[model samples]
Target: MRPAHVIAAAGAVIASLSLLSACGKDDAAGGKSGAIAVTATDSSCEVGAKSGAAGATTFKVTNKGSQVNELEILAPDGKIVSERENIGPGTGAEITVSLSAGTYKVLCSAGMTGRGPSQTFTVTGKGKATDPRLDAAVASYRIYIGEQVDDTLAKTKKFAASVKKGDMAGAKAEFAPSRFGWEAIEPVAESFGDIDPKVDTREADLEKNQKWTGWHQIEKALWKTGSLKGEGPYADDLVNEIGILKQRVGTASITATSMANGAKELLDEVATGKITGEEDTFSHTDLSDFKANVDGAQKAFELLKPVVQERDAALTSDLTDEFAKVQKLLTKYEKGDGYVSYDTVGKSQRKELSDEVNALAEPLSKLAGVVAK
Candidate 1:
């Protein structure tokens, strides 16, 4: 099935479960005298509402199609009043929401679209007091984090194994996918506010050596056909560099695993409604956890740093500076809105950051053999 379809199916289930567990008071002054019925058809959603006293009403949704789907009720303010997920094709479920007298939209989009068709309803009377489903929504996020982390670990291991076999092409293919997995789960990591400061410091280095910004200027010399004299050694140097990076694969795996486990616990708290997304936003608190993990990683790097320095202080300095830049970028997010606006930050900055980080890796990767000689 398409990814959208799978997401829709999963959402339907969560929504259905939450609806079943919901309980509310029925005040005669602000209760719907009848039920509201909604239907989803080929890219369209239809909602039926009966004239009533108004206030709080319950919507019982029945999926009359063969595809799984979900329902979302949006308030004027864009807050979700009630959302039902994982409704099996042909199964029926109900969602109760407290709404005041006004217009509201009922949206139905299968998990795949990330959005669905919407139908409006009118409630004429005083609005009823209702609560948001913050708890249930966070529970869903917990599940998402676990799945992403598992995928990341598997991909990273495969990438390392490919490097071990000297299959640079294979390793490259695995890189982006693995990187994406970690990036998606980063928000969960940020919740801890425990990331290492050293990692934060690497930002400047990454900025200076980015592939496009600075490296692009030297790409011709770096990868020319017959290894040009001075640069030839650099290419040959890299041929054996993967082996050195492969040695650290075990460390990377451990770090990824540890972060996944910690993220799960944090997500659990979110699922139980004990914490709000705002509470963990930008992972200010979780930075502490990340810092501890970075500390261990720093220890591992320390062993290699000496060898790296001996082989090429320029490379070591490049990497150290790159890490510092990353630290600074992360620290910026630590304050204010806790959002890392990669777009607003500009591509130039991003390119610079990537160059520096890659440059650091370039030299360190050659250090093993360099030190041995």
Candidate 2:
């Protein structure tokens, strides 16, 4: 979800990520405990360690830069292995990822745009074994994401067929429903860097001379022109890209901690884009997207609840209540199946939604640490 217009909300929307752990805990830091230290500035990304044993490793990411920044570990093929975004100046966050023996790139994106700085890191030997319950959680999540992908692909194909047939009203009607699955499992789709930019890039996020193709490109044509003229090619491209996404899902590498972090990232998606009315700009179907994102986050939490409950039942209980609160608030605006147009939502109501998201995000941010423990 790259949109130039939405950066203004970064400070407020993403500040919760800074509290990934409790106060005064360096156990997650790079210093004596084998965790990697990553110090980021506008001009540099300094990683304290060059190599480590392969297993679950934590990266203590600190943003020393003047602007808000993000840290990411990418595979050799350029897919994001793990990431922590919207780290404000002088704040810190931790990301715990399961690493296999291989070479990886630790990259930092200053101001959350363009690649800022990166370095090579290596892992040797299969480090440590994983818990059986953690393994089960990962397995269950994969099945869930596969189901979402199947649903998305089916709906997108139907929407594409409508456009190809020049059925303008039919295409418009099918548009928002087509995107529900993609929005739900977005973290997986976004892991494959090349596929997301092609499949979901908004027009404002289009780079110079880059030919835009994806949901938003077609979204613009459908809502603005009220016609599907010259849109057949883009619709075909959407189907093809989603097909790539389906294949990639089978090979996705995910740790238990990553699933928790991804749930937090989905809430960030809501605060930054959906709640701010930046996601479904023309269609005004932001609430539908909001519900999908929350549902996805809830699914991830539910799968991991076994481990979390064993460790910290209180946190688990708090998360369940917070998620239900947000979902219940959304229910008020429900139309027939989807939500009412976003423009119809007034300022006071929007504030209520934002407040509920913030409440959920605080407890949600601690999920990664609890699950990793």
Candidate 3:
């Protein structure tokens, strides 16, 4: 007979593995039990295994194309069973779910907007109990979160420097790439909370005003060189704008530091491969750690938002709304489709949103004078 300790250790390992499998899949290279590969282009869903045994199963989703995307596994009852967000370009995740012997749907979304397609699959036998591989993936993902935070801070600093130089062209060039850095790590942002109340109260006036807008106006004013007959005054305004931005950058730095330190602890565990024992048990501990760090970071951002808004309420509000719209557009693909293809939402709509936000910055710049008093 097996030694009692060995048998007990085996049981523990099995249980731990079972727990991890339920969390989600983390790779596209298909697992031993089976695999499903999905390509999200123009918003469509593809399933790897149309039929399988019930119990625990993993779906490996890949964005085999350009565009940011996400995948969701939904029960037949329209309930979301599992999801992975901000999967990024050319990357994928394995999502595991439990199913009774029946049918299920895989949903996909392209980009942030709520647009995409879904596919369904059927399960035949009562599924096998959860597997160990799933747990290992979850533990590994906890480590991925730390790398994301480091990348985000690095990109943010670069963006801030571009803005400081009054290099609008360079600033614009850095925008999308920098935004991707944040997007990759955003899942962790939820771990943090809202901006500081001290800052929130200061910006309440602008937040309440739906009409306030931000970046559009600044872009127009800065870009319209031919029409800028009053270029000298406009340049002065740009100088003031940059000064306010510097303050915002300072606030962002504080928020980043808090998140980075928190993420480092979790990343160290995964990077060092220190996780051992039953897979499920290890994953539970890993996930809990991930959430704690994420929550800490979320609180930091929540506290920071108000400070950012206070720098120029009108401008900040406008920027806030634009960011909201863009984010909303991206959330659409949070589940079903993994590839996001950008269709013009129309230059006019984009302009309207941008212009409104940019206008707020002007009045916001004036706040520097008021606060100095």
The top-ranked prediction according to TM-score is 2
Give the Cα lDDT of each candidate.
0.40, 0.83, 0.39
Q: Can you write out model 2's per-residue Cα lDDT over 92-129, one digit (the tens) per residue?
A: 77777777899999998886764668989998997667
Q: Per lDDT, what order, best first? A: 2, 1, 3
The lowest-lDDT stretch of 10 consecutive residues in candidate 2 is: 16-25
- Let me know the TM-score candidate 2 reaches against the reference structure: 0.92
Better of 1 and 2 by lDDT: 2
Q: Which stretches of candidate 2 lie over 4 Å from their true place?
A: 1-5, 16-35
TM-score of each: 0.31, 0.92, 0.31
- Kindly indicate the candidate among 2 and 3 with the higher TM-score: 2
The digit string of per-residue lDDT tens for model 1 on 147-181 reads 65566556555654554555545543443343333
lDDT (Cα) of model 1: 0.40
